[model samples]
Target: MKWEDNRESTNIEDRRNSSNYGSKGRGGNMMALLPIVKILLGTKIGRIVLVIGVVAYFFGFNPLSLLDSSVTPSSTQSKVVNKDADDKSARFVSAVLAQTEDIWSEVFKKYGATYQVPKLVLFRGSTRSGCGFASAQTGPFYCPADRKIYLDLSFFDELAQRHDAPGDFAQAYVIAHEVGHHVQNIIGTLDKVQKAKQNFRSEKKSNALQVKVELQADCYSGLWAHYSMKNFNSLEEGDIEEALNAASAIGDDTLQKKAQGYVVPDAFTHGSSAQRMKWFRKGFTQANLESCDTF
Candidate 1:
């Protein structure tokens, strides 16, 4: 990927130097509460208490009163880093975001709609998100509630060293896929799918729907790649293969099999390696939004 000299996005929010444990900083209160909540939820007694709390809520009891009010949450000041022009990773991310902005803007113009750019948040360890408290373990995600993309640059290292998918374009593909989710949010596709999920009684069905959503994002990433290639001649010799390798590496099936030594198709939130690669290729070759309908 030839992105070094490209334009960097102004919509980036750098929160990498903030403490993950919720010292006095943005979203500190929520961040402080999440770990306690998680620990409580991990126990059987805590689960019972949670159920009782829900039951109390139905009976007109205020569950908020159960929280300790004496513990004052203090805010920590965040030290934003890499503001200088030489931060390679941050620069690469901003450049990729700019490309997505340009590509999607043109695509939306053709459809007689204006594109609203989404903010890209760069954080470290953990951070507060509109969706909920986010940790590095949650990976990269797009929160529709905030219309922003959250990422930890450490994940790129994991993508290279742990997942064995290295290369600048592989990293770019990850950003593009998350941006694709922002596009879905803009087009009301995410809203419709979320509404449909409300009626789904089976976890399998819900997972299938999620798979479609993720695959569509993958396809949209390819659409961006197609346009980027034509518009800026951004792709190098092995860029497409790098992206394809990344898609394959992060497939739900691949991850599941690695984690458990078996595959559970019904539990897959994202598609299989073959499906991901296929959809991405479809969008790359077709180079049209209509071809990205995974559902």
Candidate 2:
């Protein structure tokens, strides 16, 4: 992938280690918390409450109670500051985001509409988002409420080491996929899906809708790749394969098998390996948004 001469996105906000850590987005009852939060805050729930209290005390309302990762761009750019070595990665992300802006802007114009570019947040450990706090373990996500993308770059290491999806393009694919979610939000696909979800007969059926949502995102990522290849010289000889590997590596079935030694379609929020590869390839082959209407 060639990105050296790419333009960096002005819609990025770098908040690597600034008063936002250990925050999570899965609000209400926290299920995944049983494994990480208890161990991190001590084996007692009372201690965790105390920690929240202390945070709210010193920082005044946890300094993150209203953690909205969306840093709406002012006329002035934010000052560059961080406590980690994420500057380079942040710059790469900004470049990819800028490329998406260019591609989508042109695509929108073709349909007699304007494109609104979303912001990207680069954080370490944890950060607050529109919905709530988020950790890197959430992987990369797009918060429709804030119209921003949240990513922890460390996920790239896990992508390579654990998922066997190693490549620069795979990393870019991760971000682009989340950006696809942003696209869904902009075009009202997300709201339509969420509304339909309320009528799902069971959790399994609802999860099925989630699979569609994710598969469409894969298609959208392919749409981004189409532009990235044509406009920027970002597509190398093996880049497409790298992204397909990522699509397969992170399939819900693969992840469930690895985590629980069994595959459960009923609980699958994302799609299966075959389905993921199919949708991603579909988008790549067509490179047309009209063909990506999974909703």
Candidate 3:
């Protein structure tokens, strides 16, 4: 939380100023063509038009380009409004990322391994990721395929306002949680889980495995916080409570109860509020890899 004067990470990719929509507004153009395509597919002649349109698309031409107001290049290239606030958020993210990089690098060294630092990509509204096209709705995620973490600054606001998890440390915990996934990827936990998931046909079994994965990541975030606090004295008075509140706020049971008025334990992809808080506290207190074995 005390990050204003801290070193900023160079691993950040600032794509906030670039257009978040698909290339040349192709996504928008497709939306415009959907109604017409739906109507045309109802008749033989319309089917022919659909085929022609498909062929044109393959040939580097778009019939949708003929539609007026479908090709707004300026709209796609416009600058971000409220740049000042976003810039401040970007700085804060870079500082926190740098802290994670430093702490994780040391932790990996203690294991006789070099830390392969992950790049963090920052974007607005939407952007392309190695896993797929990502929008703000996708939230903060780590894509193992690209070994990159994708984030939208708006999520911090939503975390504060919607989830009632305000505080800079809560934002830091979110970043650390995703970074924990990268650590899982590095340690082959993700690979093992993927293989283990293949052995289960039941969705409940698969979700249980996923819950372990998520809870382990939560523990790893606490692990990071432990070393961060020990090494740099970084935690403020209420930081841990902020993170715990966030963990509780986004818990499977809490969210399920809010959305559907009841809890379904079988569908839990992340643990209950108690489970999350327990694992995180375990890692923080125990401060060892063995303490984080959620399986």
Candidate 4:
């Protein structure tokens, strides 16, 4: 939680307020078309003549050019920009990301494999992505297509307020977990899982495989924690507890019980609450990639 003065990440891409509707800028052309349509349709002022004039106006024969893509968007918040985070939460995320890039790059070097440092996208509302479109509702996801991590900053608020995990370390765990997916992608583990899923006839079996993947990511996050604590002195009073609490709070069982007033182990995609904490602790204790082989 002591990350106020830490260095900010240069790879942060902030896209907080972008609109998906094409033809940007207050929907001006569409708005203009609507009123014209109303007048032409409702009245009988030589509808054919109106159509010609309307067509001419919409086709750039009009005085104002409303077709520019740049002017179409009503706001620029959704396009990545360097908006000053200037806050404790945002600053901590940046530092954690930079640290992961360092630790993972070195870890990969030991195996003689090149490590690709992933970009961290900090967005609000929604934004376009190579994998498709990402929204705040998508939570945190890693796109294998682009090798980037997409996260909505509001997720920290969700962790603190909804999950009862309100520490800087808890947020860092989330980031590391997503980065863990990137690790899997870089190492070909994720591609193998996808192939296995294709042949898996039973949905239940595939879900089990997914749980292992999720748990492995948790373990990988712990591995990062071990090094981060050792190298950066990132640990503080109750940091691990905060992460454990978060792990438990978002467990499939816990979330299902809360949402449906019941628990179903058979339907869990992520590991059980206990499993999540166990694997994370395992990684933290072992502090190596060999220790994270949950497969």
Ranking by lDDT: 1, 3, 2, 4
* Model 3 residue 200 lDDT score: 98
Best by TM-score: 3
Q: CA lDDT, every prediction? A: 0.86, 0.80, 0.86, 0.80
TM-score attained by model 3:
0.82
Residue 283 of model 1, lDDT score: 84
What's the TM for model 4?
Answer: 0.79
For 1-34, candidate 3 gives per-residue lDDT tens digits of 6778778999999988764444436676677678
lDDT (tens digit, per residue) of candidate 4 on 180-214: 99999999999999999999989899999999999
Lowest lDDT sum, 10 consecutive residues, model 1, at 70-79
lDDT, residue 133, model 3: 75
Q: What is the TM-score of each candidate against the true structure?
A: 0.80, 0.79, 0.82, 0.79
Candidate 3 local Cα displacement, residue 141, angstroms: 0.8
Given candidate 3, what's the lDDT at residue 192? 97
lDDT of 2 by residue, 1-295 (tens): 8886888989998776454433433342145445545565765775777587567757544322333333221212223344244567777888899999999898889888889999998876667889786777687899999999988877877899999999889998888899899888988899999999988878888998999999999998988998899888789999999999999999999999999999988898889988888888888889888898776
Query: Which regions of candidate 1 deviate over 4 angstroms?
Result: 21-86
118-157, model 1: which lDDT tens digit per residue? 9999986768889987767789999999999999887888
Question: Over all chains combined, what TM-score does candidate 1 have?
Answer: 0.80
Clashing residue pairs in candidate 3 (N, C-alpha, C atoms within 3 angstroms)? none
